[model samples]
Target: MNRVVVLTDSRYLGQRMPGALIEALRARDMPAVSARADRLVAEVRAEEGTAPEPVWGMRRALPALRPGDLVVPRTRNAFALSLLAQAQLRGVRTVNRWEAVQAVRDKPYAVLLLARAGVPTPRTFLADRPGALAGLPGAVWPLLLKPPYGDNGHGIVRVDSPRELERLPWSEGMVLAQQYVDVAGVDVKLYGAGERVWAVRRPSPLLAPAEEWPEPVPLPVTRELRTLALACRDVFGLDLYGVDVLPSPDGPLVVDVNDFPNYTGIAEAPDVVADLVESRLTEVVHP
Candidate 1:
């Protein structure tokens, strides 16, 4: 029998998501294990006439993985990517694949990919220097400054003027400047796995007052949001992910694409994801 291993940080070992997934897999009589990416040790071996081969040394012993073993990466850290890449090298199957994760990790690149594929996304500009902000179309006030690689609303700021942009303790890494969409304190979160999708409307953290934050209300997945979400999955080649859309008079503008986001409001997500993993394993092992 092939093994199912979840690669993630040790902190998530007892978290709800990975724990739920592990339960689901075990319920189906499939073997499952949780491995921490931070505990991995690898080395490259080269000889006089042979190509270098990479070998992984686990801090804690794990069941030996075979070619058909399923490796599910559950974290966004760079270490997860490295581990997944090594798994690919050893012919292990991965959920969502490593290349897709690499592309979605860069916020600016993900937005550009969505726009190029005709997915409705906000107007975004990649600014390498402070002066690049001035070249944006309309160069209007209240622009959003975001780190090219960030998540969960961290390191994001709203700048009302060019002076504010100039004074931002700019760093060498690329920054993304986006036109802020007015959502009236409400935005839609859509989570997708394969063809299944679920949605919820929540108060926008940026616009909602802390004292008056509204509860997330479950929403019927609209055709527009469904179409947009599926397009994002196809464009990004993601088997499971989430999309944040801001409702606008112009239509739903996608503001963010998350890689394996927290399925907060989606009740059936864990089981569905488990099913997908099992299906993939069966296909690879049988084919």
Candidate 2:
């Protein structure tokens, strides 16, 4: 039997996902274990201030791999994955290869990449400093101000004027200030691996009743989004990951790509953990 080791946070690894995946791997007579990547600095440095936790260890070392080694990430912290990538250079194979994850981890960076790749997305401005705002020729006013590493819209706000921009909370670091195209406040999440995919429409929690997204309502997916998602996944080098795309009058505008996005939400009515675990185990077996 081959061994699989998982690295991640103590909570999510032990109770949310990694534990169940380990069980599934074991039932197949494969050795699976969980380990945390809390000590990996190179990976965190890759994503700047972010860090990732591992959730698994797999069978054998991949190209340039060592005698007994494997890598798996349970979080979406890009900087942490950078550290893991460095370690792997010495002979370890990590899941979600760093390529794709790094591309989409930073919200602003994702916006620019998607645009350059010809994928439709909201206009974005990368503010290296307050002075950069004046040169934002393409950015519109009343823009959306987001912390470079923001998630869940926590530090997001509307900036309509230069004075407001001056009063912005971010004194250091960067931000993604992009045009705010307010539609019906609808959102979507797409999960994919190989040729299999699941697309679900989620009403923006900002407008949802009590923040409850509608049951994963299936929607019309375009080859563009799928192509873009696949490109992103390939960039992540992981076959499994979640993408969040927002809809504009023009069509779909990608908002983000979470490398280790949580499928835990599915736990509401279904065993999301088990489903994801099963899928991951299958990938390990076949890969």
Candidate 3:
């Protein structure tokens, strides 16, 4: 029987959606398991006219994964990406596909694709040095500086003025600078699970967390938001993803996108995601 393998950090498994999805899959009688991508010890061999094969683990190697199994990549560390790449090369199917995940995880590339595809997005700037951010066009003042790759609102800062931008500590590497929209402390998060797109209103990450932030309340998925969300997905051909939209005076603009996002605040997430997983497996097995 075909089984599902979720690539992620095992320690955080119980606290995240992948863990929940694993349980949900099992509950539905689908065989599932989680492999710690970060802990993986793999050796990949590449040669002419042959797909790469990865031998995993240090001591007791796990049984070789085959094309009949489905891989769901929930981790993005170098090791995880390498394993996923090898898996794809060997004909093992992955939800969202490793290529799509890699493209979308790269914030700069994803945003560029979105903008080029005519999707509304925040005005963006990229610079290798933080000090250079202060010299961007004056109109882009009050912008956000984000680490090239991160999740859960980590390492993001708002620069409201040139002086503030100038004071940013020097960090080595390319940085993403984005126009900060005033959303009145709220953001619309669009979660896509296959054919269903769910929306919720939650406190914006830019806002300081109050002693008690309001729980995210479900919102009707507007046609525009749905179309925009799917459009963003189409750019990367993502299967399971989330789109962050800011309701600004100009219009709702996509500020971020995440692959296999923790389905926070979405009540029906487990069942819906399980359905999507089963459908993908069906397509592969039948086709």
Best by TM-score: 3
All candidates: TM-score:
0.89, 0.71, 0.90
Across 1-287, the per-residue lDDT of candidate 2 in tens digits comes to 23455656444653445565556566666656655445332212232232233223243222222324455566555445655666455444555556666655667777766666666667777877554685555447767777777665556777776776666677547778778778667777876654445577777745644235546677555787787677656544555577777777787776667665554334331234334444554454322
lDDT string for model 3 (1-287, tens) is 77788887764565557888998999999988778876668764555354344556644454567778788888767778778887787778889788888888788888889989999988888888678777777887888888888566667888888888656774637888888888788999999977789999989876754225576889999899999989988999998999999988888899889888877788789889999888877674554
Q: What is the TM-score ranking, best to worst?
A: 3, 1, 2
Candidate 3 at residue 54, lDDT? 52
RMSD of each: 3.3, 7.3, 2.7
The global Cα lDDT (0 to 1) of model 3 is 0.81
- Residue pairs in candidate 3 whose N, alpha carbon or C atoms collide under 3 angstroms: none
State each model's CA lDDT, in order.
0.79, 0.58, 0.81
Which candidate leads the pack in lDDT? 3
Off by over 4 Å in 3: 46-60, 208-214, 284-287
Local error of candidate 3 at residue 173 (angstroms): 1.8
lDDT of 2 at 4: 52
- Clashes (N, CA, C under 3 Å) per candidate: 0, 28, 0
